[model samples]
Structures are given as structure tokens and as C-alpha cells.
Target: MNAVTNPHILVVDDDPDLRDLLATYLGANGFAVASAGDGAAMWVAFNERLPNAIVLDLMLPGEDGLSLTRALRAKSSVPILMLSARGEELDRVIGLEVGADDYLAKPFGPRELLARLRALLRRSHVLEAESAAAAAPPRFGPFALDTLGHRLLRGGQEVALTSADYELLVALVAHPNRVLSRDTLVDMLRGYERDPFDRSIDNRVTRLRRKIEPEPAAPVFIRTVRGEGYLFNPRGGQP
Candidate 1:
């Protein structure tokens, strides 16, 4: 890890000793590290400033890791990698289902964890660079998403976008009118192998529409393709 590319990572766990250890180890590896002892502390720290990625523990004091992960997924698209005890396969699977990007069982080597975190950050950067601009930006209704700027504007007014929603919308507009399966969208946006059973992609699309659609329930820019997936309608819901 290069000091110049100091990716900030938030470590959330209940154990004070382990939190300190992760901070020291990750910082030594060119990461700007922040640690929290439980879910409440995690929220306080995150609300203050978001990190590039989050390393969450499965066992927290009150709101457990799975619950916290699910809650965070509701609004944020920040990458999450969960840490659990060895033999916690069930916890690992559930973690993924709840929108955790990856999982590592405890008793793991610091080097291995570092490598995994680096890979996750790399993938996220790739996605951020996925949809570059052409001569003219693509338009969906009044909203025009600028891949180069990573910003959205509607009627010359800027639209608020979460990281997840921005990436999801870019993928859709880049392939207008084509039905993209949830798996394809997940793989493209997440920068990882598609978790076939994961519904997080759909969740993201829902959030994106609320920002870009006139009526989120009857979205014109992004249409649900029923069994297939979703397709972008360029004509949009023009009055």
C-alpha cells in the first residue's frame, strides 16, 4: 500500500484491544484508520465523516453487525466487509445477503485482511471510473447524469445522489433500452462477482429512481422488467 493512496477505513468491533490492533496494523499499511467499539460509536463516527470502506464485526454490543449492516444499506452504498469468528459460515452468508460486500472469519492474518481491504477498495475505484462521457451526456427525462463529473443535474438543478445510486444510474443509461439482469447490474456496479441471490441492486435502483423519477412507483426513466430485470427508458416521463 502506498502512502499517497491512503484509503480511509473504518473498523467497527466491540473489543477495545482488537480495535486498537486493527488501527495500528491498517495504519502501518498506508491506510488512514478509524475504529469504533460498537454500533452507536460506529454511527457517530460515520455521521461525522464517511470512510472509503468499513470493516464491521459480527458481534456488537447492542445492534448486532447484521442489523447494522442492513440499516446502513438502506441509505449508503459504502463498501462493507464483515469479520466473524471461525465456523460462522451462517453468519457470513447472512452478512452477504444483508449487503455486506465481503466477509472474513476471525483468527485471520493481518496481512490477509489488508489484502482483502485493498482489493475491495480497488474494485470500488474501478466502478467509479466505469462510465466515461462521450460527445454528449445521456439524458433520462429532465435529468442528465454526467459520468465524467459523477454528478446529476435536472433542469439545471443538481440532484442529490448517493454513491450507490450514481453508479447504478450510470450503468443503466450507458445501456439504454436494454434489460439488464440483476446479476449483470450487481457485477458491473459492485466490481465483484455477482451474488445471484442478492437483492441489493434492486434496492439501489429504487433509491436512484426516487432521486431521478417523477413518480418512483411508476418510474419512467428506470422500468422494472418483471422477471428479467430493469431497463432504461430514454424518452422518460415527459409531460
Candidate 2:
């Protein structure tokens, strides 16, 4: 792929050897790679050339990965994959909660890291395409979505949403009148499987329904499917 089309990834790690290794592997695997040693350098590289995804280290010289993640999330929805050392499950969870889409512990295999990176990049691209598709004045219930501009309107008033929430909404709305299982939704939104007990998808859907449905308690636009999952009922809703 051309440089413009190739997914650009920023690898930010204090370890030069690891950084170079990641850059080399990612570059060889159809991605354009940029490297930075610390948070300041990461910001510099970010300003110079915005990457499609960031592989950020949890431990940095000045600003740490979590801080950087919060900072970036405040402005942009660029995909972030955090890298932490072994035995840092707390850090991993915090990373996810703070808008980092994925995390990998150190001493990880190059292949596994590559797989995770590819999965994240693939999900990002899918979301972009879905956003473009949803922007074309599509209607469901009292809600109208402008996918291109990433805005939702309810009763002609705009409704705010986070990146994750918007993506889940698009996935459901795009396939209205169908039952989407929790696992399916997870795959659609997260680009991977989760543990059976992981409830992120359910939580996101609940939050989305509250915003879009006039009565979140008895959601009309998004309905539960019992043992199956959830469905968007657009038959009686505005088109």
C-alpha cells in the first residue's frame, strides 16, 4: 500500500532496542512506523505526523502513558494500544478505562504484538467506514445520526457520545431489525473476543439507549433479545 494508505503507527518506548524492533516488525508488516523514546518525543512525533494508532509504553520519562492517553483522548479518538511491563494488570485496566483500546505486557512475542496491532488498526478502519455510512441522514426512532460528522440528534437536539458509544450505536443501527448477540457486538466494536464475564458491550449499549431512547427503562429503539443479545427496532420508528 502507498504511504498515504498504509496505517501509520507510533511506537513510544524508553527502550531503544524494543522500539527499533517494534518499528522494524510493524514496518515490515505493511505499516509505516514512527518511534519515540518518551512522552515529550511522542507529542513531538504526534504533532509532526499523526499516526493511525499509538503503541505507548506505560512507563515514560516525563509524562506516563496513562497521562498521555488521557491527554490524547481529550482531543482525538486516535486508537491507542498501551504497552506495560509484566504483572501490571492494574495498569492495563486503567489504560482501558482511560481510552486505551488495547494493552500488551512486556516480554510479549513480536507476533502477538503484531496481531494485536493489526486487530486494532482493522477495527479503526471499520469504524471509519461505518461512520461514513451512518452519516447519510439515516433515521431510527426519534434519533437521526450524522455519521460523517460524528453527531447524533434526538428530537432535533444533539446528543453527545464518546467514541466507543458512537461505534456501538452505529453497529446496532446499521443492522436494524436484527438480533446481535453480546459476543457479536463485542467482536464488532472491540475487534476481538472478551472473557465471558466482560460486560463492556452491555454497559455501552445501556448507556447509548439512555441517550437515544426517550425511556431508557423501556427502550424502544434498542430492545433486548432475551438470551440472544440486543436488536434495534426501527420498524415503527422514524426513517
Candidate 3:
């Protein structure tokens, strides 16, 4: 995908009116828009042609956003922005936990949604460029990260990771031996503005450490720098 070109977006919502509105608005803003009414349609659309990002609605007739998110996480790491009614913080958290990058409460304006989508797509492009620039795989501690394939290998064995986790690890490894603040990691990993008091970044780092660290409690690869932040020790040499 060209950096200047518009992105392809999949909007999944059971509400026909809202789905149409989103498609129209996104199309007007120069995005190639695709719409799906439910998870089955979402799967078909994804299989036929993968979108750059997904706008998923939490409430659906069948196979709700959370289920679809989990299902998608099992295969693809496409960026997902979840939609929910106001006061559904639990659903938002679950969506994030299941691998959705961001969420927006409903009754939102088209402009706001477009802005969020653009931010995410822009971040995705940046990450892609960074990965492309790294010709060889990078090794840090027990993990060997294939930048091109976006796969992680631990102790010479492949380990599964969510897109968000891989991006967070890349961001940390990019500035090896340097501390990355939680706020910075949140912004880079979430592909959007960081929210105050959001614990998602910490949770993702913890999960990643569990997969790559010999002891997640006393992580050597990703170390806490006290008042600073987390550091990715490149003791294993850069690949």
C-alpha cells in the first residue's frame, strides 16, 4: 500500500443504517470502505480481501465483536477498532484484551471516527516502514524476531504473538538499551493517542515477557528501569 494512497477499511455492524453511514463517511474521506453485517460476513469479506483495518461493533445479532476479535486474532493481526454504546467499559476492555487496538463509544461523530482511523492507519504505515528497513531478523535474549514475517522465535522455537505485542516489542527493541516510557509504548502499540490511566501497555508488556522471558517476574530481556521505564536488553546481539 502506498503511503499517500487511501486505505481499505472494513466496517462490521449489524445496524444497516449505521453501517451505511460509516461506509459513506469513510468513502467520502478517501478510504475504500467495505461493510459486513455480522461475523460470518466479516469472515467472508476478510477471506476474499483483507482490509487495512476493521471497525467492529460490539453488539451484533450473532458472533459479536469480541468473538470475531478472538477469531481474527487467531489468524490475522489486522488492526481492529471496536464500537460500543456509552458506559460499556467492560466490553471495551474485553475488546482490547482480545486484541482490538482501540475503541470508540457510539453516538460518535464521523469526523472523530475518521480521525481515529487515519491515526491508526498512519501508525500502521510507520511500523511497516520500520520493519521493511530492517532487512534481517533481530535477536534479543531468547527471542528472534523476523521483521519481515512478523514472527517471534523463542529458544529457536516459534512463539505466537498478537500484532500489538509484536509492535510493542519492535518499538522497545528499536531503542535498545534505552528506556521507553509506558506512555510512549502505549501510543506506539495502540496506534492512537494514549489514554490516561490506561493499563493496556503494561498488560501487553507482561504478556510478551511471559512468552519470551525465562522468568517473566524478573525479566532480563525487558527490564524495568526504575523511575524511567522498560528497556530491551540487546545482550543477544542485533540480527
Candidate 4:
């Protein structure tokens, strides 16, 4: 998500009434609003212009909210507030696990939504400011990996990245062109305590590739070495 003076918020829900309510309320509260009926529409709106934050409902006609959340989080760090009609504990947990920044049950007030949106934007602003203040970020292709800022920039525009993604990127860029084993990467990631069956390193790699690679399917930057782990190529193309 790039910096904008008037924060844009995208609301994804099947309920036309709810969408109207939010558009009116958020617009009145000084926010630019976009509405999408489902995951397909959400993507169209997203690709057209990335929103500062997304309010995604849990249930949709196809590709439920959790799936959408995971897909979005894999590439972008846009703040997501998931809404579920069920209000089940499992649903909330799953939503957050899939990368929702916050969750709200159905029948929520517009004012509360506005408040949560503001909070997310506030946090995002602080992050942007920190990234802007950082000196001498490393360049790779069209990207500048801001180690101090804990973010990534492409052509001077901020590309949203999670802390875990940033850490993984830092490790990879620090040892460019070297294949680092998964175990080594797991150890390098600070505060990442793992289970015996944990494969978060691989997951993080996939997520990172989606953001940085021109073609994730045939990655040019981060290459997977058969039986060896992964290698980051700062210059891109074959290692």
C-alpha cells in the first residue's frame, strides 16, 4: 500500500446494504471508500488501486474470506479487519492466522469500524514514517530493502511487508547468492520458535517470492535449490 493523504479503505462484503452503510459512514469521516461484492471484485479493486486497509467479510459466494485473506497477505501487508456473522472463536482465530489484523462480529456499528480503521491507519503511518527516516537502504533490482525501516520499497513506493517477511528478506539479502538451509533460516529469524513439524520458513519464502519475484512460478530473484534450500540473487536471473 502506498502513502495517501486521505486513506482509502476497501470494504468487501456480499451485503449491498452494509456496503452502502460503510461507504457513507467512512466517506463522511474523511476516508475514501471502495466497495466490492466478493473475492473476484475485491481483486479487481485491489489491482486497480491498493487500499490502505481492507474490511473483508468472512462468508462470500466463492473463495471465502479466509482464503482471500491468505492470498492478500501473501503479497501485501494491507491492514485487514475481518467480519464474521458467526462470531465463533475458531473463526476469529482462523481469520487472524490467515493474516487479518483485526476481527469484528456481525451487527457492528459503523462508528466502531471507523475506530478500528483509524487505529490500523495510525499504526501504518508510524511504520511509514520509520521507513522514511531510515538511511541507506540496500537496492536489489527495482527494490530497496529497508533493514532499519523493516519494509520494502519498489521504485520508491512502499510495498507492504510483514515483520516476518522483512526478517526473512534481511537474512536472504545479507547472504546474497548463497543457498541457506531451512534450518539456518529458521535460526536466523528472530523470535521464531518452531515446532518439530514447522515449515514456516518455506511458507515465508513463498510469501516473500510473491512480493519480490517478477514471476513467482519461475522466480528470478529467490531460487529454490533442489535438496539444498534457497538462494537469493540480488542481480536477479540464474544464480
Which predicted model would earn the best lDDT?
4
Q: TM-score each candidate.
A: 0.56, 0.61, 0.59, 0.56
- Model 1, CA-based lDDT: 0.81
Could you tell me which residue pairs clash in candidate 3? none
Can you tell me which runs of candidate 1 are displaced by over 4 Å?
Answer: 1-4, 131-239
Give residue 47's error in model 4 in angstroms: 1.0
**lDDT score of model 2?**
0.81
Evaluate residue 224 in candidate 4 and report its C-alpha lDDT on the 0 to 100 scale: 93
- Give the 10-residue window scoring lowest on summed lDDT in candidate 1: 126-135
Root-mean-square deviation of candidate 2: 7.4
Please tell me which model should have the higher lDDT, number 1 or number 4: 4
lDDT score at residue 80, model 1, on the 0-100 scale: 95
The CA lDDT of each predicted structure is 0.81, 0.81, 0.81, 0.83
Error of 3 at 190 (Å): 7.3
The residue-by-residue lDDT of candidate 1 on 168-187, one tens digit each, is: 87777767778988866765
Q: Which residue pairs in candidate 1 have backbone atoms (N, alpha carbon, C) closer than 3 angstroms, thus clashing?
A: none
Runs in model 3 lying further than 4 Å from the true structure: 1-4, 137-239
